[model samples]
Target: MSDQKTGGFIATAITSIAHFLTEARKQPALSEEAGYGASPNLPKPKPTLIPIMKIAPAVGWPEGKKPTPAKGFAVEAFASKLDHPRWVYELPNGDILVAESNGPARPPANWSFRWWAQDFVMARAGAGRPSADRITLLRDADGDGIAEIKLPFLENLHSPFGMALVGDQLYVANADALVRFPYVDGTTRIDAAPVKVCDLPSGRNHHWTKSLVANKDGSKLYVGVGSNSNVAEYGMEEEVNRAAILEIDRVTGVSRLFAGGLRNPVGVDWNPVSGELWTTVNERDEIGDDLVPDYMTSVKDGAFYGWPYCYFGQIVDERVRPPRPDLVAKSIKPDYALGSHTASLGLCFADDGRLHERFRGGVFIGQHGSWNRNPPSGYRVIFIPFTDGKPSGPPEEVLGDFRSTEGKALGRPVGVIIDKKGGLLVVDDVGDIVWRMRAV
Candidate 1:
């Protein structure tokens, strides 16, 4: 799977074409600050012939070098050298489960320019590694902020991403379905087979990562399913139950659509202050540098945020044939824009006094960084303050330098969570490390 030499020549040629296209493109109409906040500046449309393809090849971190931690905090590697670690879940007993996974091989329906370009880009961005298909358990028995033991907790998963423990059953959101297994507190391994809860959308599987979360009472489950193709290019029939959030009953496994038109809501959590569900969504691309911005919003039940037709609420995308003006009229504007093409994929709000008091009432997000925009954005961890369940202050960079000085991706932060010891843990999928940051 790590075969760079195979498409090296074609990829090199494509890079040259990309540079020309970027230069021909107009500069961003909105300023950097306009790309964020609740009322972000949405620029005019200037769709490109092909998606803007640019990337900093993923190169493992150099020995002894790591990300720069925010002031008043110290950072350390919780676990290192993992194979494509993508997401994390902390058990009630303080055990951390990291999903070591990569997308399963999926060829395009018919090979074309877009397909080849995406394939080359994904491989160079540290996705060339095959899925490890297992969740490893890390334990900090001594509480030194470093995991003392790293063991295979569960094996043979199908690209598992989100995990949660509710009572005696552990729910794992594999790409294809929701499954459960028997669990014992403080155990290191599970040999028991999983019971399928329900199937998830996976055909074509353009966006295969299915993020999962449970309710406060643990009586219900929410799974975020992404669109199978960009803008429903493959056909709307393939997009059934996609680009929407599915709510499932833990008892009967019956699922229903919670919200729709989110594009790709990779993370979901409940707002402790407002008692509302929220999600971070990745917006549609290939439009322009500032036309669409990825955002986070309070997910209202039976709501449609508008995908493949509109973005940032009421702004219609003309590319979609057979216009849906009715849907555009009802599109809900997001609560906050995370910057265009920032690829904001992970979200977790601070509910308790877990971390430092300065960061007590805010949300920690992991922006996986962007390849669709030049001068790449969001390769770090950021904290946005909130009050009364709404964002109140500007964002602060919590961790940075995810890419090397030579324009190589040293890491790409994916999932962010608060550990049992009141510390922040970030999953760096590209660097293959889980970084822990605690107050000094």
Candidate 2:
């Protein structure tokens, strides 16, 4: 089939699936006794409609701007021995919680001579063992600037990604659902059982989950559901394949799709100044280095970003071909393109209120190193400047030199968070450390 025809078919299939799911959930089943006896009664649910909005194309950065170095950011290694730390949340008492994504290894029993030989041979065979996944709370008990480790907050999570603190509650985004626990101040252990807030589709592996954010008032929660496959061309079901952003009511567990056509939005945050939702999306790869551009965009309600059939601020997807001619006029492009394959992971707005005047109202995103390109790109943090709630310039490297001169990386950053004291904490999953950046 032609690219245009394929795009149309995919779009139609996705819409039909979404509609069916929505309608099926709304319908009520008939009770046999009520049907045979008195008047049947059933409450009708409200119809939900997904919104689609148009966004303007992004402008590129000005000429002759050099990338900034990490030294200028005054990065200091704060804590170590973190295995795949995914997200960091700061508490009111100057303590921080770090979520590790790996699973625990089984302890070996007493060794016999034959068992020792077998273990040694197996170790040499290089079998991959599961690592521990736990949440650790760090704080400085003394006046020293360094943070000391506390007891594990929770253990045996299935790849927890993002966390949020609302009042006395701590909500964590686990692989298949949102789990919550009562977070008492100055306590290392959560004595209560975790309550399930929302269940999400997970474990397809192609797109792992990340980044859960709540509105300022904690009324709504947003979760990122990544696409099941790259470009959705593998003929996966629409309910499982299409990339989407989900919004749920905090009081109720009811959730609905907030936006569609976003492939894998790794980092999502609400702009401190504008209160607008912004996301850093990892675009589809393997078509060429620059065919589709990864982006940091202001997500809109019901926005149709051309995924599978369009990309990078309205460039018709050549692989999908012919393109959706109807969508060509309506498809909203990204707000700012952060080069192709930058692998943007974590996003946080600079609310220090003390950054360089030009740095205020901007965002800091951790690019988690890339693998598709020749020279290898994105092993550093970048800045996206905004003015009056819109991006003013292209993404500029604010933290650099994480990658070696030959482009090999010594560390990979996964999530960025601002601590209680207004310092920035970046999680380096590859280096197994968390680095803190503070103003000198």
Q: Tell me, by lDDT, which candidate is best.
A: 1
Per-prediction TM-score? 0.96, 0.74
Question: How high is the CA lDDT of each candidate model?
Answer: 0.88, 0.64
Residue 425 in candidate 1, Cα distance off native in Å:
0.2
Best by TM-score: 1
Clashes of 1: 0
Tens-digit per-residue lDDT, 1-440, candidate 2:
99678756855554465445534544342221111101112222222232111111111112322223444556666677665566787777877888877422323543333333323322222212243457788886773446776568888666777788888888887767888888888888675777999887764445656568888998888888787666555444633523778887877978888887788887888887788899988887645434355777788888877776666545565555445767655668777766655678898887646545456788888987555433345778877777887777656766665655444345667788776565667887666667777665
| TM-score of candidate 2 relative to the true fold | 0.74
Candidate 1 lDDT score at position 52: 76
Looking at model 2, the pairs that clash are 51-302, 52-302, 103-131, 103-132, 104-131, 104-132
Q: Write the per-residue lDDT of candidate 1 for residues 247-322, one digit (tens) a residue.
A: 9999899999999999999978889899899999998888877758899999999999999788888888888887
Residue 160, model 1: lDDT of 93
